[model samples]
Target: MTAPRTGDQRLAGRTALVTGGGSGLGAVLTHALADTGARVVAVGRDEAALERTAAARPGAVLARQCDVSDPDSVAQLAGSLADEHIDILVNNAGVPGPVAPLTEVEPQDWDDVFAVNVRGVYLMCRTFAPGMTARSDGDILNIASVSGKRPLAGRTPYCASKAAVLGLTTTLAAELGPQGVRVNSLSPGPVDSARMRRNFTMEAERTGVTYEEAERRFVSRALLERMVTEEEVAEAAVAMIGLTGLCAADLDLSAGMVAR
Candidate 1:
C-alpha cells in the first residue's frame, strides 16, 4: 500500500509498541504510526538509538530498551506497561545472521539468530497476547521477509528463522482469532538503507562489478525492478494494523521479489 501524502488520525487513541524502533525500517515505522495519531512505544536494546527515534516526536513516541530474545527482559517490559493497553504489536526487531553455507554455520550464530527472530516473537506473544485477548481487541504484525518463502543460499540460518516466523504467525492467528485478536505477517524485499548499501558494496567486490552494476543485477530478479522503499513498507504495516478480520495472512511488500 502507498503511504498517504498527508497524515490523519485514523489510529487516534490507540497505543502501538514497535520493537527495533530505533533504526532502519523500524525508525520509519515509528514515525508512520505516530503520524497516524497513535502513541508509539519505540522498543530496542540500543538506548541511544531509541532516544533518537523518540526525539522526532517527543510527545508521541516513548523509547524503551529491552532485549526481545530474553524472556526476563520482556517480562519486565510487560510488567511496566501493565497499566497501559497496547492496541498493536509490531515485532520488527531482527538480526541478519552470518552469511555462510549451512555446513559451515556456527552453533552460536544459529542460536543467536533464532533467539532474536523466533524466540523473541514467542516471548512477546506470550507476554502480550493474553492481555490482548482479555480486552478482546488487538493486532499483531510480524516483520518477516520474502526470503522466508524460499531458500536463501549462504543465509540458511536467517532463512530458517524467518520460515519459523511464518509458521508461528499462522498458528498464533488461529489461536488468537477466536478471541477477537488478529495476527498477520508482512514480508518486504531488500530495503534501500545504509546496511544494504554495505551489502551492495560487498557484492560489487565479490562479483568484480561496479556498485551500481551490482545493485542493478540485484534488483533484476524482482518484477518491480527495484528494491523496496522504507515508506512503502511502513505504509503496508500501517494498513495491516487497521485490518479487522485478516489473520494469518501475509502482506507481501517485496516488490514482487518472490513472484519473480
Candidate 2:
C-alpha cells in the first residue's frame, strides 16, 4: 500500500472505525483516512449525515447509525461489523455538556456527559480491542479536549469525563502496547466545529456578551489567536496512527495552549 502525502497516510490498506463520523472533526478524520486508502466505517446517531459521509467514497465506507451510550445498539453494530476487522479505532463520539457551573448544572446533564464521553470510549475499546490485540497491529485514538487537563469554569462534567478519557488512554496504552496495539489520546483546543459554535452561543448568553465577542475572547485564549480547525485535529490523528515508530500514549494537539 502506497502512503499518501502526509505521514498519516501510512494507514493505507487498513480498516478504520470512527465514531461521530457524521460531522465535526470525526467527518474530517474519516475523509482523511479514506483519502489514504483505508476502508472506513463511519458511526453516529445521524443516519443521513453518515450516509453523506459514505457517499463521498461509496466503496470505501460503511455508514452505521449507533448510539454509543446504548450498549444494545453498540452490540448490534459490532455484530454487523464482525466481517470487517478494524485496524484503527477513533473514539470521537462526544456530547457538549451544559455550560453551567457545578452548582447550577443538572444531575442529568452530568450523567449524560459521562455516559457519552467516558462510557462510550470504554465501550468502543472493549468491543474492538480484542480484534486489534489478536492482529497485534492497530491503533486507538481517543478525542479528548484541553478542558480535560485544564478545567473550564462552566464545563465541570465535560472536564471530568475528558480527564477520565485521558487517564483511560494512558492505561490502555500501557496494557495494549505490548501486543503491538497502540492507544493514544489527542487533546484538542477549541476546534472550529458546529459544536464549538454552539458552545460559543451558550457562552455568550451566559456571560451577557455578543456571540462575536465571546468567540473573539475564546480565540484569544489560544496562542494562535484562533480556533483550531477540524482538519488539523484529523491531521494529528492520521500522524499518530501512520508513523511507524512513534507510539505516543497521550498526544496534546492543542494549538499552543498552556499545558496543565
Candidate 3:
C-alpha cells in the first residue's frame, strides 16, 4: 500500500473561516484552502452561492450565511461553532463606495460600507481572538485594498474603512503577538471581481466612456499593465496564512502597484 500524495498539505488538520466566501475572491480562496487540505467554513449572506461553493467541495466545505457588519449575527455564528475551533480566518467581505466626493456622499452609504468592511472585521476579531489565543497558533488575514494606503479620488468612505483596517491589523498584531496569534492583512490591487466591474461601470458612466475604456484606464495605472486575477489574490491569502511568525503587520500583494 502507498500513502496518498496530497497537495499543499500545509493546512491539513486546520479549520478556516472565510467571510464573503460565496463569490469573487472569497470563492476562489475557499477552493484554495480546501485543496490545501483545510476544512473551510464559507460565510456570506448569499445562501445560493454559499451552497454552490460548499457543494463543489463536498466534505471539506460548509456553508454558513453571515453578515459580518451585524454584531448579533456574528455572535450567533460564533455560538453555533463553539464546539469547533478555527485556525485560520479571512475577513474578505467588503464593498466599494458609490464614487462621489466626500461632501456629496450620503451618510447611509458611508455607514453601510463601514458596517461591513470595518465593523465586521472588528466584530469577528473580538468574537474569535480569544479562541485563537487559547490555541496559541492561529492566523487572521484581513482583506484590505490599495485604497487603504493611498487616498483615492471620490471614495471617501471606502478609503477611510480600508485605512482603518490597516491600522487595526497593525494594532491587533501587536496586542495578540504574545498570545501566539498572527494577524496580518493583504491589500490587493484591482482584481476582476463583480464589485470591481460595477465600480468600473460607475466610473465609465461618470467619465462619459465605455466600461472597457474605464478598465483600460485602471489597468494603465498598474505597473503590470493588466488586471489582477482573483486566483492570484486567493493564492496570496493562502500563502500569507501559511507563513510563520506573521504577526502585527500587513502584506501588500498589489503586484508593485503600491509602495511600502
lDDT of 2 by residue, 172-251 (tens): 88889899998888889988888989999999999999999988987777777777888989888888887656554667
Off by over 4 Å in 2: 1-6
Candidate 1 segments whose C-alpha is farther than 4 A from its true place: 1-10, 202-210
Tens digit of per-residue lDDT, candidate 3, span 1-260: 97854335667879999999998788999999998889999999999999999999999999999899998899989988888898889999988877877898999999998999999999999998899998787889999988888857777899999999999999999998888998999998888778888888888887899999988877777777776889999888888777775677677666667752
Candidate 3 runs further than 4 Å off: 1-7
Cα lDDT listed for each candidate:
0.88, 0.88, 0.87
Error of 1 at 88 (Å): 0.5
Q: Write the per-residue lDDT of candidate 1 for residues 63-127, one digit (tens) a residue.
A: 98999999889998988897779888999999987766789789999999999999999999898
RMSD of each: 3.6, 2.2, 2.8
Model 3: pairs clashing at backbone N, Cα or C within 3 Å:
173-248
